[model samples]
Target: MEKITHISVELRDWIVNTMKTGASPEAIANAMIKKGFDPIFAYRTLLKLVNNTPVEVLAREQQPYIYEIPEIGQKGNIIATSDRDIKVLMRVEKPFILYLENLLSEEECDELIALSKNRLKPSRVVDTATGEIKTVPGRTSSGTYYRLSETPLVATIEKRIEELTNFPIENGEGLQVLHYKVGEEYKPHFDYYPASKINENTGGQRIATVLIYLNDVPQGGETIFPKAGVSITPKKGAAAFFHYGNSKGQVDRMSLHSSIPVLKGEKWVATKWLRQSEILERS
Candidate 1:
């Protein structure tokens, strides 16, 4: 018979209990191996269990991302929201970037920054291995998030975004406002979560991002897409909309981007991450 490759609930509980009782992870893996578990499977399962993250066993194989024209990426030069007319500044098809101007007004931008400044906290990134949010060296920024339509300003912005993108507010993961000071930068990274960590209830996969610039930077603070050789300057009221995922369960690697260090003035931006399905919590 093949070695045990599946972990039962009882076995998973046993591993957790043993780990809390001072048993090393290696010892647990070795025990599982001795009990006829595949060596690799034993080690992998033990690691996830120790980290307190789900040990997701995926049967799906990796497939190339199929490119499809998203509604927001269509050949439109203008998006008419209920309160504003946003002009398409530029477009890049390879990675699906639709740069826009006037996504927010001058007053709106200032208010968002004012509201977020007081609530700023050290930013955190999701640990790929454990699927937990933690502060790391790669990302150096301060940020805050607001619930969907929590305030009048946020409600107005979210509604405008819904009108522009044709995606419901329920699919948005709330609006996150980030601030970067001189020398603080977020290294190159993708916005989407790891495949195994995508929670269906929270909205399956992160499909796109609407990054709105809130303040003008004297220098640097450009959003760089290294693979695509693209750089977007920070202009107040302008935004970048990049679609990276599709219904075919594919994520575009070319959408990888980063916020380079600010050389002069501070940088402020609000990011709205969209999901493939409605986020249950927000819905």
Candidate 2:
């Protein structure tokens, strides 16, 4: 660990500005660590600054709502897959939303939950303007990623998702399993990378998201779309799919969503992000 006798006032100002722009407490702490500050000191410093900051100043910056919805080629109440027939219970156009039922079996859900139990770690969010992954206070859940086709079970699920979404499997990231305990939640945010943040070195903008609910929360833990004024309750074996990007390089701001705080039991979900291009080893 490195020792620092001086905590510069400039550092404080930087933290304040970053927070105002929606940087997470953990992201600030991470930036400090990269600057040679001890991890513990960086974390505590950010915590104190966050605690003292006003709510309005620390709030996430809101973007103007976008009205465009990407095309989903499949038409009908049911999305056919190689192995299962997924029923589309609901649809919303603006953000290209679909509420799917019977997307996963109880056995599959249990198996996924079991496989992820020991590997879960804190979930992270991508920096809005930097494309950097940061563990953030805004996302208060533990998660783990499973490589594509890592197991026979995962392979089957990935295949099903590919068929359901009509997306190339090669362009999709690995499966991400997330577990949110009581009181934990993910703040509202977009699935696609901001245009300002895109660069040749980075993976292309995210095209869509497939979020599967592995278990039912007896109380809260709904997936809320703030822009659309819609909330989908987490149901075991069901899933929510949404598209936020298209070929013209436009990203939908209406795709802003969050995981509502779990009020009773834990919430478990699996997420798959599809990109326009093949992302590096991981997404």
Candidate 3:
């Protein structure tokens, strides 16, 4: 939102020419800095131009056909293929189903909704490109979230983990729900360690993630991993499970994902993150 300084018609033409020659924004910014321009000014100017340009113009300026995750599964019930079986869906391989169809009853859904009415709050929204911070605006799209550590839902979700993975479940800092209304979507990103500034190694390296869809959207609202070629739609009461850490504590890189924009209706999901250690170091 802050305006960039040092951006002029000449600088704009230089940037456009450089881009025509296949220079990335980073490369262009560095080149300008070396030529006595402020690096931040160059970077910010580029961002402003990109943001202000029409989508069609920007598309012409960048790569054509950016890869996207395709919609694969639907709401209700379906089995998921493991990484070994599918090879494309990366991380831990196993067949699993969306839990929304059978995990919780309508009454239970109502209960969870009632509980969320007061507890759900805005989630931290980060602009990965600019390092800007803002609270997500509303319950629509990638906005509001309820931290699971403070909710009864955590216990229920852990029991399901035990039944499915046969691994003892331990409580941690808890999960967060990302609710999306029509037209809302989360961009591609990785779910790993939050920066030190946020939690100071508190999450102890996320090991796995379980996302349970609480409400069904008539269409769209899929969890997508473009690199993995996987997309799963939102279903009432169903969950998606994926592992991110190895037995030796190395983080798996394949867990990067995104949420496809909701085209119609609404979506609500409950997320559970498994940690390598207890949330609290001291009892």
Candidate 4:
């Protein structure tokens, strides 16, 4: 990283005054650029100064709440909050990854794999241009998924959620086990629609999504969010948590995401969609 110039006392005073008047760092940097200082230099300088400054010194500061995974069936993990504005990443440690892999014994994995041969189903998708339903060709290789109802795995995951977020997950509306063989993939799409458009039977808008990768693919399956610049490879037993809504109750646009196409080996995963209200209430 390039070192930024030290912020002069004069510039510090300016930053304090500008911040007091509700100007963002970007705004201040733009102003400085118009005054002849290089925009990049001003932005970098401001970032270094602000990051070096104590939180108590800033007029506004966002204190992040840490969510640690407790010992569940024999292992613990930690997932730190990413950014305040964007609730993007919640990564797991390696040991926790191993623990999750162990959750399902090798025999269980083999049984699931065998069962998958008979359970493989094609994914149904819609065409945006022509308003027609279509199947993704060759994209449906060999994969199987089993829905979750009230399984022990579901209960364990729920317990972990309560420990991490202090939020209670009631009964899950639906659950699924997804298996991808060598070349299966699901394209990009958002999970929840606006409240005005959702059907009565589908219930309220989805609040969060928990995706747990069951078996790791030796090559090529990744969840990529093109717009957000995030790509996560499938890791056996690791989970990804993504929240869709903001404090203002609006869903983020950049959250539009997709699943990467599998390339060389099979992949297996479990998914759960959470809603804002009970299914009965929505009905």
Best by TM-score: 1
Q: Which stretches of candidate 3 lie over 4 Å from their true place?
A: 1-101, 126-133, 136-154, 166-171, 194-203, 281-283
Question: What tens-digit string does per-residue lDDT give for candidate 4 at 1-283?
Answer: 3434334332454354334323456756665565566667777766755676521233332222233232231222433222111122344331111112233334444554555567667654333222234454423534443344245545555555444443345433455567676656765565555433444455466655666677777788887666566677777655566655433444544445566777877787766666655555421
Ranking by lDDT: 1, 2, 3, 4
- Ranking of all candidate structures by their TM-score, best first: 1, 2, 3, 4
Tens digits of per-residue lDDT, candidate 1, 5-93, equal: 88754345445544543346787688678768899999989878877889754334334457888898773898788888899989998
Off by over 4 Å in 2: 1-73, 130-132, 199-203, 280-283
Q: Candidate 1 or 2, higher lDDT?
A: 1
Per-model C-alpha lDDT, please?
Answer: 0.84, 0.78, 0.52, 0.50
Q: Please tell me which predicted candidate would have the highest lDDT against the true structure.
A: 1
Looking at model 2, report the run of 10 residues with the lowest lDDT sum: 54-63
Better of 1 and 3 by TM-score: 1
Q: What does candidate 2's lDDT look like per residue over 1-283, in tens digits?
A: 6464245432454455446446867866776676577888777777778888422222223333355444343658877777888898999988789999998999999999999999998887766433577776778899999988999999999898878877778878899999999999987766665454554433577879999999989999999998789899999999999987766665666677889899999999999998887666554
Candidate 1, superposed: residue stretches over 4 Å from native? 1-63
Steric clashes per prediction: 0, 0, 10, 3
TM-score of each: 0.79, 0.76, 0.57, 0.53
Candidate 2 collision pairs: none
Error of 4 at 78 (Å): 2.4
Give model 1's TM-score versus the native structure: 0.79
**TM-score for candidate 2:** 0.76
lDDT of 1: 0.84
Name the candidate, 3 or 4, with the larger TM-score value: 3
Clashing pairs in 3: 82-94, 83-93, 99-237, 99-238, 99-239, 100-236, 100-237, 100-238, 141-180, 141-181
Better of 2 and 4 by TM-score: 2
